[model samples]
Target: MPLPEDAPELSPALDPWEGLEPSGGQGSGGGRPSKPGPGLHLVATPIGNARDITLRALDVLAAADLIVCEDTRVTSRLMQIHGLHRPLMPYHDHNAAKVRPEILARLAQGAVIALVSDAGTPLVSDPGYRLVVDAVAAGIKVTTLPGASSVLAALTLAALPTDRFLFAGFLPPKSAARRETLGELAPVRATLVFLESAQRLADMLADAAAVLGPRPAAVARELTKLFEEVRRETLDSLAAHYAAAGPPKGEVVVVIGPPTEAAGASEAEIDAALQAELAHAGPSAAAAKVAAAFNLPRRQVYARAMALKAAAP
Candidate 1:
């Protein structure tokens, strides 16, 4: 999708660490200050390309006494790219509970600590929510250095409605639960953004089509990197496409259009629609048709049809 001509040109010069105060005990006095005040710095890293990091993020990484990250190796590579050599520690779902206190102690000691994830912004479908929750409860100075985010990047790439969107972050693993989740979100008026593995894209799309009807959607993958691709189609069409071709490679973001405005229906009108559908399709199919047509509950329509069936003859 072509960005608007007026859209701010996103460039590599956007780095925040270009020229700033030296960090990590570099002072005019040549001696470390007693303690850098306590705070938690939320840093954002590149989703794919290495050069997408910000200069301010580099400054924070260099200045902080210690850095906590989802993957030490991943963050290490990022820091190495920026020529930053700070003490990096692993803080993730597996050990977050055990490491939270240690991080708190550092903050309590007035040490500036930086938190980052393997990719993109922290706490975005990634770990670090609990840490932030705990830090806020402790009244610690928590600040964020925003930069690249996969969600924003995908939204831009998908060419979908960005003014209003809901990041659903990964659907349930099981089909039933996934369908229920889709059903629950079917009425949302905002464009729905979902993070899904390549393998499950087809099934998710199918479930979304069944629950939300044939809405327009886009499947974006390999974002910000070489071989990036965005496939746009109606939900049902996309489902069939993927179902036949199988899933594609790389991470995927499924962006779905919002629900269409439903036309008002009278009970008599619904009954008539149901009666017509029932003649050929069974109760379930009839209910599904009426539900899709009027955007109403299948069960409710089914019950009403049953009552009508009971009253007939």
Candidate 2:
């Protein structure tokens, strides 16, 4: 029977020990076997398109004694698409603590386990970190089969400076808390990346604009899928657009450009801003906020804040 149209093409079989001298091992008297060696393998699944998975990732998935994933149903579908049928175990946030010990025990017994998330790389805002940490602490080998990541995908589409960038997974949902978080991130002189819910996109963009000013930005959604879209605009413009449009469909990633040199703020202007922040925050916090807002040095702002504090009645 012919393979399905969506099925991955298979390469012709080759001898596993074709190019090796005998080291007293497995195939042909000492060569690597077709199977993955025993240990934990952090596998990266396709972010959206199932075909985005790497060849080596498929190899590990095929050879793994067991596959540990965020959602068995989702991973099962991916396996089905790729014509794989490994035993899968659920290892998500809710059950990780309960199941980790069992996984570790199996690893201790030399099981080749492949760890994968529902989408993208394992442990990127997923529950795999603790497992990796435990695996390492237990002296078990841990390695990664890196592949598709939404973070990188969004950044690539954002058209912003990528040399210095930060991936801040997600922001708080509430407006006040989210704004505070944005305020804290204001001083970072790099492109900022964040994953957010579609429902919160407008509000998040608004808060970002309010805190980060009119920096260039892009909001990428449905990445790598048929409907993938990237909207590049200034922070305020994106915020306005989203507010008017009332959020969008699918997963959202916001990439904001780094701070640009603003016209230097006068002493009076800095002092006034400092006073406003100090009313609700400590001098240090106030100084940081003002410094970030004005693109001034934290030490300079802090010193001025202290002076203002000393001079106050």
Candidate 3:
């Protein structure tokens, strides 16, 4: 989420609103563009810090015909703090089906609408995707204004690999479902991020260890708040801690590091590497190279090598 250094300057607080506007028009956006376009603006609000709101986001909110949010009270508080009052309408999961048509009608009439989640970015663990899909299908312009996100926040301090990471979101609550989901992600080969209820933290971590083996993991809670905490340990140890100490308070994000090559490489990759070595070398020599390359056990590699050779012409 970075830009070229040569890009025209805007407020540094404008994390995701680059070039959308000249940083002015209404609210804190001190100047005015000669013209303003009407479309759906997907705005990102703060995860915790109220000061994290961007100047451009405030301007969009001020200029929009109406603001769609999960809760009017939440948006009203933000509006009060910024001294920018705009019309608010509820568009959460329960009423989205009934209210989406009304929102479309307004968009068709050239209304500039701003969509926001209660916290963080919109459509993250929310029901906003369908609206975006429908808007695009209806030829309505839709864009996003990114800002603070808990997912990124947890990732930064979790001390895990970010080169390749997967945001797996939340698993099912039941033990069997959670274990099944964990088994499915057992070989993701990247950091696995999940949002879990505070009450379910212990059971979830326990399931992760049993299904995911001894990979390094971190549990982050109460992020950006007074009592923020991030605990890093192996899957088994983290599970034992949470199980013994009970669930920690507030929102939680679990980040699990990817497995090492011995455990991470797929069966197909192991076999391919083995076959290439087996083509010219005898079974013992071929198995040694393949085992070293993938950091796998010699016995396993040698067994696979024998199987491949026996089936060969």
By lDDT, the better pick of 1 and 3 is 3
For model 3 the local lDDT of residue 51 reads 84
Give per-residue CA lDDT, model 3, range 1-313, as digits (tens): 4456798877778768555545654454556743246889999988777888987787788878999999999988988888989899999989999999999889989999999998889998988898999999999999888897889999877766666789988999999999999999988777799999988998899899889877667899888888889987778899899889987888899988776567567655777888999889998899899889888666556756775676579
Give TM-scores for every candidate, taking all chains together and pairing residue i with residue i.
0.72, 0.74, 0.76
For candidate 1, lDDT tens digit of each residue in 86-155? Answer: 8988998899999899998888778899999989899998779999999889889999989998888887
The lDDT of model 1 is 0.81
lDDT of each: 0.81, 0.86, 0.84
Clashing pairs in 3: none
What shift in Å separates residue 250 of candidate 1 from its native position after superposition?
A: 1.5
lDDT of 2 by residue, 1-313 (tens): 3466899877668666678654332244544537778999999999899999987788789889999999999999999999999999999889989999999999999999999999999999999999999999999999999999999999877766666789999999999999999999999988899999988888889899888877768999999999999987778899899989887988888998776444765445766898998889999899899889988766556655765676578
Sort order, lDDT high to low = 2, 3, 1
Root-mean-square deviation of each candidate, in angstroms? 13.5, 15.4, 11.6
- Which candidate has the top score in lDDT? 2
| Per-residue lDDT of 279 in model 1 | 80
lDDT of 3 at 14: 71
- In terms of lDDT, the poorest run of 10 residues in model 3 is 27-36
The candidate that wins on TM-score is 3
Q: Model 2 misses residue 223 by how many Å?
A: 1.0
